[model samples]
Target chain A: MDITSPAFKSNVKRALADKQLQRAMGNVKVGFVKKRSAARDKLPEFDQLRDQARDIKDHTLEYLDLYYEIYEQKVREAGGKVHWAATAEDARDIILKICQAHDAKTVTKGKSMIAEEIALNEHLEAAGITPVETDLGEYIIQLRNEPPSHIIGPAIHLNRDQVEASFRRAHDHLPDERSLDEVSELVDEARQVLRQKYIDADVGITGANYLVAETGTSIIVTNEGNGDLTQSLPKVHIVCTSLEKLVPTLEDVSTILRVLARSATGQEFSTYTTLSTGARREGDPDGPEEYHVVILDNGRSDMLGTEFQDMLRCIRCGACMNHCPVYHSVGGHAYGWVYPGPMGSVLTPTLIGVDKAGHLPNASTFCGRCEAVCPMHIPLPKMMRHWREREFEHHLTPRTVRTSLGIWAFLARRPALYHLASSVFIRALKLLAFGRSRLKSVPLAGGWTRHRDLPMPEGRTFQEMWRAGGHE
Target chain B: MSSIDKSKIDTTASRTRILNKLGATLATGKDRDARAEAVKTHLRQHKRNLVPERGNVEGAERIALFRAQAEAVAASVVEVKSADEVPEAITAHLREHNLPARVKHGDDPGLTGLPWGKTPTLERDSGPANGDDAVSLSRAFSAVAETGTLILVSGADNPTTLNFLPENHIVVLDAKDLGGAYEDAWDRVREAYGAGTMPRTVNMISGPSRTADVEQTIQLGAHGPRSLHIIIVNGE
Candidate 1:
């Protein structure tokens, strides 16, 4: 909702110094990485399924208009409505009107990134309709008035004590002596509080993990069944999703489903993978009476046929973020958007202008782990490099950095001069180190030296070593 | 213009504009017919992709795999010899877990005609769950042995709410309805509901509701059933 990517340097500084955030981020590295590897190891066809998942998305994107038409027709035939929004503002307006028409005072929500992209909750709140986030992590973040730090794990930046504090502050009606010491105790508290919200809310909003054109079904996968309750109990169920979520058939969805949970949370399947087609049918004792799907384009339409087209294949599994080393160090809030990590590095600049989010592309170590672990096989590092090139071409890069790059390029053209200059610089750096192997501080590399010591040159550059006939 | 009228206009304009952008980028010139045909063929055929061998078992092995996978996800499983024994199995499960003797169920014939009368001590009500129920029961349309997932299609017979509202969910899945993989279950769904048609909901429940959102440590019973008990009736 807020563009803090421009201030990413300061955000990273704050995040690095936040001891609680650093400790909480440890879970992302230790928890998601091992679980995903184990789950992938168990399934022999994991890679094949990933390739098939990629193919399915590619095919659908190639004929997306036709698939959208078919999907719309199917949804209408099933007595549901599909409303298309060209932008985030349009999406928020469409959803708010739906709630207003229902005279909704309170609406329960499942975790939907599209809703976050559209800033739907804030819009609804401004319209005097309270939105209750039913997912435990979302509920905790909502109470704290904070955006999700991580997509899959929203309150991941928070520890148990922080959650206990939030619960105490929000649930003032409850007994003060109640125990919120254990994680399970916190879960039970949220479950108890949100159960009534599910029943009382007039409308429900959820995001679709996959939208099937064959049956016009919106599929949501959640370990917590909050989404099932959010949609099933309300009088109106609204699916707020993006155009990229569409697939051609249930079988295609099944192929993708095989890889989604494994990459996201490492479950064979989420506890619930509910496929809802439309509103409550005849003689249906439960489920919403009305169903509506609001599909938002939201700058995604522009990514098509571009180098970033592979990004539309993303299933939002958060695997790239899970495997990301930079993400592990800085955490998600520093990225300052709905998405974070490598996918965000490429995607943020596309949605919000590159002028606002230029630093995001530079926020990577380019270790290639995100692409290796990506189920869609998206070349995230390559995309980020593309963004950097765009940033340079647009003249959005800072003058000092651009001047330095210009100088480097000029020297790079003449290798002999580059070798002489580099050797001189290495000799100067060696003199500065005062015979120590590492320099704690260096004249123009304060950013590197501030965090850790920079190693002194090992007496020779690669070109010098290669030319001495010492290269056996 | 009224806001509703403006919204209607906005919807039409947005749909057209978005579709135009997609068509412009995707269907530029020559191969439009091929792209359309590719989509039509893909949707029409609905071909199955690679199904993992883990769920490719048959007959008794299928049942065994389903039970093992279900237990692996923290769902308890009980196998009975006939539909007549299902009521007793459920009661025994409830008793073992120190739950209430009462259970709410939808009007699915497979569950409705069960000799629930055999277990007179257990109280059973028929309808969708209303949030106060401690246990709810529904019949699985089919189950996938590959992931131990129960596929339940929603209707008058099996309300979708029964699967999620209660603290404990007891599902009665016939052994014959169990398949080896998700693809097999989808095939059954297509045969029953017809191609391109679906019930209001198709819930593929694998285990009791859980959340690992808190420090990524999973805890069960997050706004859904804490315990899921599957009673598999293997009729003679």
Candidate 2:
């Protein structure tokens, strides 16, 4: 499940070979991208709102340390526990201790990207405690013993038959008579299995969609109400999130929610908008008895006051992923991290060492779809290019790419040599092709012709054609 | 007052320094409550009952419409012309759904007074429904015309589990019980609870339990009430 391992690449390559995954990913492009556009177009106010949302996050990230305190105080006032974790290890260890204290044998989890960032489930399993992923998407991947391929659609690489097969191997209680061909049957089976876990689980772990400093509320937006059951049924509830997830006030949380739903799923709002205060208050019949909030820094605190600070404004809508051409082709797992798509390309380098994730930044076409549809208006391509520039400056760029760039730079600097070389090159390439329409494979340039036809020089170079016209 | 509080950490001194740094950058000359204005405007649109109803339907038709919508959401449906007929309606629906027709702590005075002892009764105060063979009749606080939402207030009599944790949900609502707005419904709940005793849960459910979790496929009653039945008695 670790991104640094070779397993990550192999998993992606295997997914690439999966025709179903390719189709599902292609479907994502039309589904989310088109729907978000239509949703955004319907609300002209969306742009104005995006600007405000970004500013709110920018303001919050700048004063993150302050907001964290204010939020902590409010939670304490409501008799809740708050823990600050500077790294994923710290966060996981803290949660593990809490579980141990409660003598918890089974843990039920709601979908939280921070948990993925920290690899929480692995740590829990290492401790010999069972952690059941309750989100439908998260459940599928967890059952299949694979990491989430995409952020929003965790099992986007899986189809119905694959899921049925996975279930046949996993769920022991699944009756033979239950129709396994249709998707609904598969869903019902998973639900029945998960329902048992919910009842047995003593602790519930979830992620906050937005943490309101004003009310000290960690808000979760879910369609399935699984999060509600996770946090409610268990005696203990834990919220794990990044430092940047905080908002200044309740009003700000609402503003983000407006854009969060629209950009993420084209919905006005997610169905279960649970605003959980501390834990269950005195005489409260339904909520958890104890609530704990864990905020993990995970190198995000350093991101503040930097040019790339805008990246933190992201609501994790996956819009950038939906529109990204590189992501559309390669999908999320190829990015090799918990975060995938454009944001991952920018962040993976920053967090996991630019040297390790150097291939991620270079994978972009710089088409700017990620930037254009961003709900927070993050300049993604600019950030990616900045990372590329950083990589080149840091000598992280490979010898081959650098040598080619150096040759192009040298040629462009000397125009007379460029024209002389270019004209000679065109004539030589044309003669070599025998005036054919395309070059099947040429020396160093053969890589270009692997799947594409490199066109032969039609007439002359642009310099020659312009010179022939004599300055029109 | 505006939102839920998840946690409250204390780093007052660090917070002050960070805010000072932030103020030096952005809060130059004007109040930045202008930013807070965005959330204020959006909270306005999330209003559900703002949608105007087509035409007012009272009496059994209103009850029938509620029943039909509830039943469509995996809830059962029953129609009774009078409160006296409620027992028969309740008995038939439960028999069909295979749930025991019983009063699990009677919160609805109208349904309980309908001579339930004459027809058949399994138990009283079945405690929690526990997704077993149990169904409890409760009165809807108010119904929203636009979304057909039924507001349920949980007290000692009406356990919150009946509202949730049930495979099938049956609600008894009067037609004239339709409230004005979500705000109006909230006001009614606050009034019913009095100053000192607000119920543990006040649920405003328009439709049955729903989820789009399975590859974004819509499924009703993922957790709460696979079936919702509204027995309308001339909206009495």
Candidate 3:
């Protein structure tokens, strides 16, 4: 919720030095990458389904307004209410009002990024209503009073010991010497602690993976059934989501569903893919008494026809972040916002201003792993480049960097000068290498050389070698 | 204005503004009727898109694939010859797992009509599951063999609570009701509950609830069923 994107450099420094964070980040590198690749290999139509998923979202966005109208009508017909919010503040207020109207003292929550985007927990706390996060990762971060580092795994930046500490601190009533060194033990402890919260809560809130207009259904694909219990046990259920989550039909969502879990956690299907429509029907033995969906615009409507429009096709799979090299090194908190990794780099700048989040887009190494793995096929690197261009156009880039880029551009426009300068630069770098293949440090490139040694260029440039008949 | 009315007006205005923004981008001087028709047709036609070939097996192969896939996800699957043997199979499973013989189920006639009395020692009750329920049983509306998912619809017959509240969930899925893909399951739902209508909840559960949140090391039975046992009845 804090605008730490402007201080991304400082965040990076701390994250790189954090021993716990680095250790925790190893899980992202080793776990998600292998699982996703293996899952992709098993399904023969994985790529074809991805293409279909992209087309479905593209078609939905193209006719978003009509879909919204139809979706709203269906929700009303099912006796569920739909509320619209044009801004984050509006969304927070709408949810708070719903909670207050129910006279809610406590509200249980399933992991909803829109709730984080709107900063709903803080708003509810200010209103004297306790919001309990039911998702295991979300609940862990809530104890630490931290914003989610990763979208799917909010507490992926935490290790087992850190979770044990959070639990010990929060569940003070539990035995002081209980065995919690095991992951299963820690999971069992949270299950016992949150079970009461699910029942005591007056209302439940969740995020929608896809909102079906055909049946007015909000679907959630979760490995853990926290989302199910969160909505089912409570008297009232609220769905906090954005406009892009809408799909035209159940069949369309099924096509997207085929790719969502595989791209996210590499499962053919998540353990629980629950499709809920309206409130509990008449004679239904157990379910929420009321159903409400809060659709937050939050500047997303502004991205409709823009280059960033492709981003709306995202299913929040977290594959881009999972495969990102920059994310692997620095971890998620370094980005300093709700979302992290490749999707966050492009999205954070749009939600928050580029002036504040300019460093995010620049954080990418342009390795193109994100685009290659993205289930929605979002051109993440291209979008990040667009943000950089916008930052330059608006003069948001630092003056020194701008000046250096200006000089590079000037030289790039003139082929003869570019060749001569590169040749001289290459020879100077070769002399500095002292006949070695690398340089420990370089003048005016301290930042690049600080982390690792820079490889020395050859004595000649490509132009010189080509002219000297080295092409063969 | 009153606070309630003011909030109401704000939401109304926000809805109009959001739709207007979308219109400005998508329908600016374009054929509005064409756009609306395109959306309507897409929703109405509800065409299946790109069903994976992995789930296209038939008959015994489909049932076998479902069992294998479910087992792969840590769910225990047992096949019996008839619905009459479900009680004995469930009792054996409970005894083997060292769980209590008591189980709770919904009022699904298919389940109630079964010879639950065969295992009179197995204490059984009907209605939604309370937090104390250790094992809850519900009949699956259908199953997807492609990914080993069981589809359960919510109603008085099968309350949604039984799916999540219990520590161990035992579901009775008829082999005749199992399908090859998620699309097939959706087709069954459409036939049962007409087009553009759905039960309050349609749960497609592939395995017991699990969480990988703690350092990405997945632990089973996080906030939902720790163990899911499904009994597939092969004979009518």
Steric clash pairs (candidate 1)? none
Candidate 2 is scored at a TM of 0.79
Encode model 3's per-residue lDDT on A175-264: one tens digit a residue. Answer: 999999999999999999989889899999999999999989999989889999999999999999998999999889999998999999
Model 2 per-residue lDDT tens digits across residues A1-472: 5665224455556767878778767767677777787767765567877877887787676556556656777787766777777778878887887787777899999889989989999999999889999888888889888777677778776667778778888876667666788666776676677776776788999998888675577877776657767877777889988777888654466567668877987754454555666766655545667888888777765666576778888888888887888777777777777888888888877777777787777777888888888989999889888888888999977699899999989999999988888888888888889868887898897667886888888658987788788865
Tens-digit lDDT string for candidate 1 (A1-472): 6778899999999999999999999988999999999999999999999999999999899889999999999998898889999889988988988888778999999999888888888999999999999999999999999989888888989999999999999999999999999999999999999988998999999999989999999999998999999999999999999999999988899999999999999888998999999788889888888899999998999999999999999999999999999999999999988888999999999999899899999999999999999999999999999999999999999999999999999999999999999998888888888899998989888887998999889777777878796775
Best by lDDT: 3
Docking class of 1: medium
Question: Candidate 2 chain A: worst 10 consecutive residues by lDDT?
Answer: A3-12
Q: 1 or 2: which has the higher lDDT?
A: 1
User: What value of lDDT does candidate 1 attain over all alpha carbons?
Assistant: 0.91
iRMSD value for model 1: 2.5
Q: What TM-scores do the predictions have?
A: 0.97, 0.79, 0.97
Ranking the candidates on TM-score from highest down gives: 1, 3, 2
lDDT of 1 by residue, B1-236 (tens): 13334345348888999999999988888487787788888888999888888987788888989999999999999888988888889888988989999999888888888887789999989998888999998899999999999999999888888898999999989999998988888889889989999999999999899998888888998989999999998873
**Can you tell me which runs of candidate 3 are displaced by over 4 Å?**
A430-438, A455-458, A470-472, B1-10
lDDT of model 3 at residue A38? 97
User: At residue A354, what lDDT does model 1 achieve?
Assistant: 95
Most accurate candidate by DockQ? 1
